[model samples]
Target: MIFLKLSYISQSRLTGLFSLVILWTLSTNTWAQKIIRAPYIQLAKSNSVLIRYRTDQATLSEISISTDGKTFNPSIKSTNKVSEHTVAVSSLQANTKYYYRIHINDQVALGDSSYFFKTAPTVGSKDKISIFSVGDMAAGETQRKIYNAYVNRQKSNYTNLFITMGDNIYCGGSDGCWQEDFFNPYHAGPLLRQTALFPSTGNHDYDNQAFPYQQDDSNMAYYQNFTLPSQGELGGIPSNSEAYYSYDYGNVHLVVLDSYAWGKDNFRIFDQENNIQLNWLKEDLKATKQDWKIIYFHFPVYTKGTYDSDVSGEIIKLRDYLTRVFDEYGVDLVMSGHSHVYERSRPLREQYGLSSEFSPEKNWPFNSSGRYDGSDKSCAYVFQNVEPKKKGTTYVVNGCGGQTAAHRFNWPHPVMEYSLDKRGGSMAIDIEDNRLDAKFIDEEGEVLDQFTIFKEVNKITKKTINAYDPIELKASWPGPANSYVWSSGEKSQKINLRPLKTSTYTVTDTQKCLQDSFEITVNPPLGTTKWEELIHQPFESLEIYDLLGRTWKSIQKEGFIDQSVMDGLPTGQYILEYRLKGKSYTLKLIH
Candidate 1:
């Protein structure tokens, strides 16, 4: 009886445990089919939108979305697959916000099931966008912590997209690594529900069986992860195949390119032949009319980090060609990665040497400056004067995303405006009015660097004017000819003049810009002595002086020194005239 009782108890315990296991699985997978993952809504046209999402598990059943959660209305145009699906919600009003949800049913209509989404406004709308970017993200404790902190603090109402620059995983690539490096760090936060990640194929992400060994691998896990804009010119191939494309976000035009495709090993293998991307670039930039044009790729053209120009390399060649193209068109800013450091540059021209002065001539190519200098003296001063000198372009290397410190760079990296190698950082750019302010922010929310870029409304105004000379001309006598006063207010001496009618006379020289007037009334009375006549004359020759004042020439018609006299005198400063009546009189002249 005891043995039988023990057996019954053991059987009961095992049965109870099995029942709990089944219940747990059912609970987790209850709404898994209809409750999709990574539900993303992209703006299309006329309030119409495209919704892309991945299902929890495979399902061949037709899927649909409910405008109202209570109805089992299925969208007719939706393309459904076992793993992925896309549906278009259309015929809605422009700029109007609507709430809808996703639905998937296999056996019977699954009513009351959905995920919320909103359609985008019509073209030219003043829509606000919030985006995040990262590069060199690998699986690590601190990286994961920072990522979690960032997403937790972010607001989901307007956050639209996230960009992942290369080196997304470490140790080449593996499915397990991706799960740890990306999904794990993001799982704790609300990021997956709000923002969709757009990733470029990094070297590590390509080094796994998840993507085929072929260069034009159609089966990469990165491709399956996000849905990018699907309509643009890209190597004459479908947008999905060519990962390079352009998109409009509010007033900014963004261009994303694949820098790795230009490498020798990758170029021939991927068959990225004929420079199709370059032609597309020129055409795209020419046609774009946005307030700002920003481009991003995985390789930096300039950096003072682990990745330095080694004289002869593919990067140097790429820089030469790329800089010419970017400068030819007014590309406002270019961002890149692969250096495992963060850096910004001045409005750079050929780095070989600086221009004669501030230059707006964009045709000049960037020259090689070899290596960074040891001190930041010159660069620091230049940075101080770094105003909005013309339309400046900054090259940012944002590769210090999630990795160990690669290398330290000394100051004086050509075109380098700022550099930092510490990890756990990102940037925020705010576009307001015609000026764009970008702040480099670290994980702790500290501002590393802040700078502003201005839109060229009209070319800077230029003007020039002449200043007037301050010298004045005092006086001259009939008495003084070719007379002028120095700026010091001094007088000039007896100037030889052919006294015609000893009457008031005015002398002016516009070329020399001098003017003077003299009143000499010679009324020789018949009775009085000539000296008395001269003394009382309006031309009172009381005191006289030679040009240098070293000699004196006086003529009192009374003591009248009958003069063929005073013929020789050098030109200089002197004093003359007398107190006629009550006022003091004076004359100056250049002999």
Candidate 2:
């Protein structure tokens, strides 16, 4: 009996040992399914964020989010078999920190410490915003240096946005290059996983050799990997194409254009004649009531880098064409890359001619000194808040994020206030209220250049009056004022205007250097006898229906259209519907 019991014990021990080996093998296999490319965050909105990652093997992916850094809730899940996984977690709170983890096939791929992202503040909130801008990154050590420098200097929690000017990859924009040069440098580190990257497309991003203008198979990697605002869901016009888009953060309106692609194709912008982008841009700018407007793209309008703005036909064309649109729409700052140097211009206006023909009186209306002291006593430039016209805009070429190339021509452009090519760096912009402060920091965390743009707050009261009714506009300042100049060329604090039609008047304070604009909309009484002759604004739609609600005539047109349909209308009461600026109005008319 003792021998039998001993044999049973030995068999039991063997069974236990075999079970341990099986468990060990399973754990080793699970670890071997490592994530080739760790998860990164993108398109961080007020209530949503896109998480993307790649694994060595195709697996079901999921993400868990937690606000208290513990007790994570499974927010998003995808069952598709994909090595690359992208999932968007939505309905999150604004301006809140969220800790997240990646799980592939129910196994933890990445988790634990420091994996968190803060959602953007509520739109139009007065919260102070900080942004980092860099370009020509994703090379090697230099790119890492620039990124590290920015991360070291900036507060870990305060940074709200991160933007890349262009050239996100080096040599060729192939999948392999993106893996090694772009993703590994930014995503393999901690920056992109926390703060999303908003990138502009450079020539190198679309295949350096081919430089394909249109989005096709050559640039599929860029188009598929990065997602941007395109549906006008973020306070801009619907671009419908990810190549060019816009978004709003607080009171700042950011316009990102396809300067390299669209400019190279045909200098087509949203404001260009017959271009859809131009039309959308015009409407978008008109709709934006923000206090600050910033535009960024890949190519520099004014640069003295490897390519000369004056000599290069493409550069000159883009500069002249875009400057007009930017100035007309009151763009505050323009940021660009592709120059491989850092150049900041003074507040420039109407500098459409070549560099040799640039005139300070016409172009450099603001102080030519690159430095803008924020104090009221030493303020350099005071841009007006009026629409369709701004005093000036500051252009910055910050392409030295990854690589630096010596300027071929004279170091600085005529309007340049600061220029540097020796070191690579990034730009930090802090926007608060009506003031925008920008700093250029080198790889060593040194402030190489700094400037500020201040916009004086302007308040104008809008007035609506009936046609033939004279309207008097009285301009008053909160503080002591000296004189006022109206856009009608009147130098008076009180201007009496008799307008037969709608008009806009801008009044500028000659003493305080402040300006305000008011619009006078003259509309005739709803039911006037002037049916045969009616003045209509461009893009206005008109429709006429009988009392029975039967459609008699409909005209979807712009400008003046003769009321010829009135002649065919029966001699009875008819309803006239007019649509303009997204508002519809009904009027009772008799024929």
Candidate 3:
């Protein structure tokens, strides 16, 4: 190639040299950056985030970060020339908002005040986190509506996190399908730039020509298109595989699993005793110490929506294998989306069988609507610290994020306390301390359903203390409750009492979200000190307890005890708990 002054070129030779110049001019267009796919955020952590984008041709990629939109730090540049670009920016403040921009070949391609993201809060931080999730949202107007609805509602409180329950793309999950159905809708201008996408795998994501569906686990478009917290960047055990992983946001531990059949192996997640995915999940669940544990995946363990959980193959297996693990670990929530509907269950446990075998009395140990709205025996599910590890788990089938209006027979499974299949919506979950609130926001921006769960709340206890002993009572439901009022008309978090006799006291929050009761019984000196005197007094109820705390005798009568009855008692140490003149008393007697 040669460039010479036009005037110096001879007329006969100008035509030959002109073709080279023309070719060079056309080749310059390739140098210009053509961003085919807009920038998206991913792999978010307390102090780092990953930004990924695609271009039409090879070009230099650079990213600039700033605390304010007007000012930016030195740009982070990658010299590698490639169509796909991933820039991981680290060494930042935790839970801090920052503006960013992408520069393709030294020109600003994406950046502004509106295009900013907030880093995840420090692990185990008390800061509140808002998460919005959708499932089976491939391509449709409904998907856009759901996205816009959440964005509109986020004006007052911005949430920078988003998750998907898979089937992210339609029609064989091709690269073009991903761009058209997924990347375009959440393109940089709308959501993807600000909100990090943490996605799970669905069968449709593995659908290749409908024949090789889920036949290639490592080669699926879903695995190729995104990078997640697979290396323990967010605080769980490093899975080293994208199939399943865990991430921590504030005090919440989010476990994303892959239940789809892996390539040609004809595998279920836990089909074998020593499966890699299952083993990773167990380690991840065991390793996370976050206050709230939530697991999300593609196939719902229990549902009677468009798909039947009772008869489905993988669904039944999920129920058989996963519930026991979740119960053993005290998993707070289990969310999935294969069925096309909205269904939520009461806190369930020991429920592993066909749908017809679902016994509410046996499965739902703490049964209630869990709406906390005072309608139809509605009460928040409580997780006591001393309760069994198999406390209860709330299973949610939120598959209708973009698809809806489908149902099977028995649309509302017996295990579910709330069910809705008329509209399409996504879930908005808010967590802070011991409380979690979730609402299903419909496409039209209406709240279709909502539920609340409280941990270590609404307690009742019985204590036996010596007379005039000081007993301190503390209210549960997280520290610094909205407002606390005790039965003694006190307005404090804790109260110390020195009662001469036994009495019952109760404390309730202003909103009545939680209540704690103390049934106090004042005990006399050891060894029948007051037994003789109390035997001649009238009492309402007398309870005789053995040294092992078992009730040996219970007499509910408004009469005095005779000496003959005391004499007839066997020789042993006993605890006498009797109410005399409306005041409870306890005495240790050796008969």
The lDDT of each candidate is 0.49, 0.71, 0.75
TM-score of every candidate: 0.57, 0.69, 0.75
Q: What are the per-model numbers of colliding residue pairs?
A: 11, 3, 1
Error of 1 at 2 (Å): 71
Compose the digit string of candidate 1's lDDT tens values, residues 168-200: 777556545665667656544544433434556
For model 3, the local distance difference test gives 0.75
Kindly list the per-residue Cα lDDT of model 3 for residues 420-460, writing each as its tens digit.
Answer: 88578889988877889888898999887788888877778
Q: How many clashes does the backbone of model 2 have?
A: 3
**Candidate 1 segments exceeding 4 Å error:** 1-37, 40-49, 60-81, 90-100, 106-127, 152-157, 171-177, 209-216, 233-241, 262-274, 310-312, 350-389, 408-412, 456-591
Residue-level error in angstroms, candidate 2, position 542: 67
- The TM-score between candidate 2 and the true structure equals 0.69
TM-score between model 3 and native: 0.75
- List where candidate 3 sits over 4 angstroms from the true fold: 1-30, 209-218, 263-266, 458-507, 516-591
lDDT of 1 at 210: 41
Residue pairs clashing, model 3: 215-263
Q: What are the clashing pairs of model 2? A: 270-277, 270-278, 271-278
For lDDT, the strongest prediction is 3
Candidate 2 residue 264 C-alpha distance from true site, Å: 13
